[model samples]
Target: MSGGADLPGAAHLVLADGVAHLDLETAVFNAMLEGWARQQATRFLSSDGTIQPRISLVRRFASFTNEYPWQWDSADVEEFINHLRARRPSFAVSTGRGYQNILRLFCEYVTDARYGWPRKCYEHFGEAPVQILHEWNTVTHSSDYEGSPGRRPLTYDEVQGLFDAADGRVEEIRKRRRKGALAAMRDSILLKSVYAYGLRRREAAGLDVADLRRNARMPDYGRFGALFVRYGKSSKGGPPKRRTVLTVPEFDWIVDALDQYVDEVRPLFQPGKHPALWITERRGRISLRRVDEAFETARKVAGIPEELDLHCLRHSYVTHLLEFDYPERFVQDQVGHEYASTTAIYSGVSDEYRNRLLHRSLKGRHSALWGHCFD
Candidate 1:
């Protein structure tokens, strides 16, 4: 509240609508948001640089409600989030964040209602109770939002079953006389690459055939061999990042797909040049959408509806790796995450692991030394 944080600013009372219209002092609003954004940098959009863009989002909502003075009182914060989720066509976690980031900006600036700001904000968008809304509303959150259910990774058997089913299901598509034979091949490679490595869709789609290979410079695959992974979309701040993930199956499968596309199918496209690893035969280029649809169709054919989407593949991959007891550092790097905590959610794969560390320690060696309880 240092920079005009306490000022009520200019106010116009809207008596009938039960809300006040406070004209925010531009400087005060800017400073407030600037501070708040910095305070919540871990939230992704909390950086100082995010202030203006975040403000734009808040203003956009203000344009519609143009009701003036977005008080936190007339409505609840959580209600506003819910309304946003409902109004938007898709309520993916990413979308929910659009609203949260804006509101967080508001929270930084406006601490009180020139009148009903808090009530209105709460009424329209109920207090999230949790920073990131969970699956119940619209899947959005980084570290398990309080009360917001999060995704858990699938077991090795489950991931293996999905991959196995995909292999068997390819023959089904071929039997049905599917037109895109290359599409079928694409599906196999996509699943193998994503699930085997727990890759984000962007990283997978963003690849180029030239990206994979042994380089004496980086030696990402080590001196003996090479593999490539360009992590185009990152969960952490800043622009998409670049990292080289070296894995034999991941390298081999992706290389095979590239060969099929360029050596075989890509030649069918009209004369044009593109660098993306995944591209359509239509000439424009293969895209994230084509990859999505291909995955969906393959899932339907395989009949594993519980977990079949791209990220679901990620979930399965992470869980399977955890089950195998891979080092957290290695997993973190492979997943392109900045820290072990970010990837810790995958540890939910088993209570056995937690019990070994938490519960088992309670029993210690000298149980009869004194009165004690597991609590």
Candidate 2:
């Protein structure tokens, strides 16, 4: 068949015209993946970050079944999911659901008449791919927040302890006349900035010096009044989202910390016109792994639980903003959440805040019931 414009995924375009190959089945399978990748890239505008993992997962499923997509069935999907669930450190419910969704999408693509994959497979192997994932066999999205319960917002004291530990590391290194004192100081400021701006790890790591913006209203904060986040998390099939995270009065301490880091400490790295806000010892932009390492080192020193991660700083930011009486919509916008429910999910307001809220509600509704009890 000639490659045609109307054919989805350009299945015929990817398959060799007249090549003699020893392993025809493998070649066909690779061609299917290549065609799928092209469809995702050209038609759907999917990034490599989104396409590569999907291709890898499809290959893994093929390996697990020891058969091609045409041979896959509901039973294979069930068994594969079970195998994943039974592994040590078992996959989370959301992760399993995501896997099922990807597999379902792939199956849909291959089985569709417009894709030409079904006919191609039938012509070659007398079998065609079928959708294997069904509601009964696949993991269901039963909860809004399926992330680990252990991953919660840190208490104010815990956040303080973590920052103190990071600062203490800088002192320890400086006293010993050791290397990494600058790095330790940078990490301290980085951790605080993550909380101050409610940033994801990538958002924090992706920051440039120019991302620090001046707010006309918050003139006191100077260049640290807001953060122009260029690498905000993207929706599926979209480029990185952008947002401006404004500085609030509660987290204004970050202004001085950032001012010091940008003006003095960051220069020690000799970045030589490097634009990255977080520079490494090598005068390169810091990586996400290094950000994690910085958090982990301080977490251990601060004696925080292992379950709490770098992301917890973000959670803490949301929770604290709510505690500080910020409007829900304001918090949602600050964190770049598309929905207020997502902001609520990240927030774990303190018992004290909840009690105060309850007290205020009761006082407002039943003024006589309180009888000056709150006072």
Candidate 3:
């Protein structure tokens, strides 16, 4: 293989069947993958995420067809998608559609004349790769909300129980003289902060000491005034978005919790000069997986429903803010949603709150009718 340095399996498989000539098919396939990777890297301007999963999808499709991209057609794609649908834990509609979309991009890239893959394939193998995915065969984005029905906002009682269980974990560990007491304390505060600020897991994990700022209006809360989120979700390969969330009166207890953690418990980790708000035992920033695991462990101990996950804390935040009669646009901005409709999807107000709203509407109507009758 002439370009064997970078390709995963290009070392010993260059000459085909003891032939004197280099294998054109193997060389072209590896080149196509390399070109696609470079294109993505240049487009995104950073390689933090989003390339590896796509490459894995290409490899899986190749394994399924046992043929290179040039040999694929619509029928092969249809059979491969059907096989995925028939698996025991079949892929969700959104998952199936994502797989198809990535494959479509690969085909588009390989068949484009500018990349030279089509010309090289034609010159060597007498054929070129063509797009196999069409609109009729792929999943459509039918609704704004496509999440599972089982997942919903946790009720106020459930949120309290979850927090209690997390705090209890710290005490339980400390009583036994165990080693993970500091880590548990960090997880407990981290979970509370997530709900307090209506934050995504990544946003919570990306926090630094400087990200916490003081609110002039709420000077009594001191340094735990607001959070400036630097890594809000992006769209269309854009840079991470940014938002600032102020501390509300309802979640003011978090001020004390955060102040204690920053002053006392965090020092135990010996994270000298590290800026991350949540420090792991290794003296580095905690990963997103640990944030999720901490939530799941607390939920199970509190006997909460299994469907509730870390995102549910954010959902609960939106729903409770709505219950407290906060404006819809305010809630949307707090959670960094680009659209109010996206924020609405996270809101699932309790029946009691709905009834109160209904009563208020009736009372206003009744008062207007009485005035009209008297006049």
Clashing pairs in 3: none
Point out where model 2 deviates above 4 Å: 1-5, 43-46, 368-371
Off by over 4 Å in 1: 1-60, 63-66, 69-79, 82-98, 106-150, 164-173, 176-178, 215-227, 234-237, 248-272, 347-375
- The TM-score that candidate 2 achieves is 0.96
Candidate 1 per-residue lDDT over residues 149-257, each given as its tens digit: 4445655565566666666666776788876665566566666777666678777777675665664654443331343676555444666677776554333444554
Cα RMSD for candidates in order: 10.6, 1.8, 5.0
lDDT of 2 by residue, 283-360 (tens): 999999999999999999999999999999999999999999999999999999999899989999989999999998
Model 3 worst lDDT run, 10 consecutive residues: 7-16
Whole-model lDDT values for every prediction: 0.55, 0.91, 0.85
TM-score of each: 0.59, 0.96, 0.90
